[model samples]
Target: MATSSSQTLALQRNSSEQNRFMEKLMSKIFSFYDEQSLIDVTFKVSNPTALVPAHRLILAAASPYFENLFNGNQGTDPIIEINDIDSDIFERLITFCYTGQALITVDNVAAMLNAAIVLQMDDAKNRIVEYLMTRIDEYTLQSAYTLEHETKCEVLKQKIIEYETQNFIKISQSDEFLNFGAEKLQRILVSDNLNISREEDAFDAIQRWYNYDVPTRQQQLPLLIDCLRLTQFKVDFLMTHIQPLPGCELLAFKAVSWIREPTVRPMTNMRFTEPRGVSATNCGEKTILAVCSELNPKLQQYNKTEDKWQEYASINIDYGGYRTILKNDNLLFIGGWKSCATFNIVRSWNIRNKTWQNLPGMIQARRSHCVVELDDKIYAIGGRDGLSSVERYTTSDGWKLVNSLIDGRYDAGAVTLNGKIYIMGGYKIHNDKTNFYMDEHLQIKSVECYNPDSNTWTSCADMKLFHSSPGVAAHKGHIYVLGRGDEYSHVCVERYDPQQNTWSQICSLDVDPGYIACVLLDNKLWAIGGQSESAGKSCVSVFDEENFCWVERCLLPERKVCNCFVVPETLLFSM
Candidate 1:
């Protein structure tokens, strides 16, 4: 909050002088240096050098990330130089060490961008890139494109085009990029060699990848559907040159599948081969939905005849409670149990890479939370901690701050529709300052929704009953709420319609229950896992939409607070 301009100038001048002196002093420590590699130069500025000690300089940079900066060790052998970096970067690096602030400008922006990108400074890189992406125009883009290599040029061009397509004016009428099409991307003066060929062939290649079938490719469909929306309409006449290959429809389906359900989950259990009470649809018609689940730990694909959930590739990551998931063509698992950590660790798993990487640690570590994938970003909602507190993280713009909930609770329900986030129920937030539990219970019944696009929260209609009361799921035109108390829970089902901004009582659940996690399958709503006195039930239960009956199904591997996701075949079912 210090707004003094003179103070800033003095601080900057001093910081710069100190770093330059340090660099100069380091140079003097070792004239035995290799100019090209820059690694042999010594930082003999340790204690007994008769100068301000190296330990002193390091102690100055003692932020938490310093451990990561030093490769997770607080102390290490002094290094003169690091590879693949120059003095220009070194100055900035030293600046970060000297002062925790990094200011952006016309000159150092490019280096800062590169460094942040390399070091996984995701938040910083996004800010720099977004700023550059917006200010640079056609002339600048053309210059960069022409000056850079083909691969790098393509990458920049695609990013600019995407920035434009996603945020700016996109000429939606074009055809080549329509539904897996990429039209003449740049209107440039180029030779024949630079031209792309088999334009229709690209379309054919995409269509074949999805293999559009329900049970088989259903999990993979959402992403493909989203991509289809922004695709520039390619020429129908171009179809003459683009012949549909034998299976190109599937590939095309796969292209759009990117936006379908979003986020591909790593395989947990093996394939599950069976569905309870799958009967002939009146005329000997069999229902085949290749539904994958998070709770059951189904053996891979469980196809008795061929029985294997074919996995082509996998990105190994440490994750659990498969319920907290989000996807905008990228699988982001926000919160999950890690036995080593006191709270759920936050991590991101790129669907394509299959590798899990650590993200910013949550402010309040939690478990059994809900996450939503919107616009290629994630929003983590409430879940109880050792003490319940609400927190969220989004990766789209690199984990920036958003508003938090008015109160904290666990077992709360969350859903995202039309870009707004809605949160319902859980335990009360503990006010350590007051040192008492507020039994008002008034906060528990309320509903609050946050808008990231505007960074604000507004009240919505509250449920007639307790949401933390148990068993909630969202389906076509409604959010189904079930259960009420713990040992004394209710099977009372209520439906919420966001459009009308109203709630209505639906058919009550027909099974024994204490708590339930509900998900929609086909037109029917399925509520699973609630405590009951039923002898044969193992917690897994289903509701008959048409028949209005609840059918108790076979048990999941264990009792769980299941968070269900139904990604159609294209988004996640294995080959």
Candidate 2:
């Protein structure tokens, strides 16, 4: 028995050493392939044909297509002719086979996936599909769905379906949703995982799709209507909206019958009748809260769907220069100046209850400071009196000091993006040399970023122009800073790319340059009311990302220096 155990241990040691040897050998082989050394197989790829070299052993091991090709051909160092696949994609796949790494991005993912499928590289195909799954946004969902149909990848199909289910409301509003085929549309409408507020929304989406091209899509309406939970709709809605539709008359009658009689199921193929799994908030309509004045203390809510504004709530205290951050359902009002004095007080208003509660104050009293929320913690950074101190707040632990800024600044535009806090362009107060009591304010164009993981603040690329209390927001993985142009006549909008650590100016705002409040709502950047050259301007404008211009939206109630943020429509109605 002891001899047998010793022999087994020796075999295990040999197996471990063999794995180490194979790993080292593969690494060396990849290095040789990188240098174009020891290349035994060459692929002549079509579509602007290019020759790509690779080792047969690596390709055969990674892909069954190459394995079968190499086994059938007896010749050594054979040049294989490949067609249809782009040369770039084929080269990337060949490199992936050798090095086990591929540069799969949105631009190349579709081509790489198709090439992987053609080459019978299941592993590479799965990786590419997973990459596509992670990036299934409105812009890419249509292409991904098309790829799923072209490649016949069941996993990709299910992933796209699940994304449609989870984001049904948002997806329904997208142009891609209108382009969905009848079969694909039915798959999403039948899903129980759909995050919709009511069954009527599902019907509405179907109606919109049918109306997009009524001549071609009229016949698809009946089949698509079977996917909705008809019993979930109100009797009036069924009669008024569904029954009157050209193709939905039969489904509407069955739905009305099922709603009236609780015991019997509709004698039709409409399987989905129960309510969809809705989230806490109805995502169809969004409510934006704009706090314009401290003295007037009015909280206004703007309904995007209605294109109207109404007074929602009010704050009793008269304060100004405070920053507002909405976390979950709580809107936090952080440090501000009142009666010519700065206070460290922090107050939170529960949008659900419509009540305000005082929380723990900061370590230092600050006004005109930038407050941002990241990783479920709120950070108060750089404020008045040349304050370089920074503090963080959590519900359980209260407020604690974090890393201080490299330079003290107030009225800076701060935003959180990709797990980092960015503070950009503000004013720094410096004492005058001749008059000791007099203070001089200088506009700062410098920028700094804070990383919580490292607990450090690093300098970023400086803005082209100075920004004092400018509007800032993060969108599409980039930080957008809207600075009121001091030198130029237009408002300068610059976008900062974190990966490149660079800032580039995009289209300028059409409104007169001033201290404007910027917020991102419904995937669009909005510049709200701010003091223009003469007075506070009530004009509002939204950035058209595709057109690279700012288009005018609805105006605010009054022309004032106001901060705006998005909230659920339910929050405003709850009051």
Q: State model 2's lDDT.
A: 0.77
Off by over 4 Å in 2: 1-284, 431-439, 487-489, 531-537
Q: How many backbone clashes does candidate 2 have?
A: 0
lDDT of each: 0.45, 0.77
lDDT of 1 by residue, 225-260 (tens): 222211122334223322243333443333333324
Q: List TM-scores for all candidates, in order.
A: 0.43, 0.54
How far off is residue 49 in model 1, in Å?
91
Tell me the tens digit of each residue's lDDT in model 2 across 213-313. Answer: 99998777777777677777889988998888777898898888778875454233233444554211333467578877766567878878767677787
Top model number, TM-score: 2
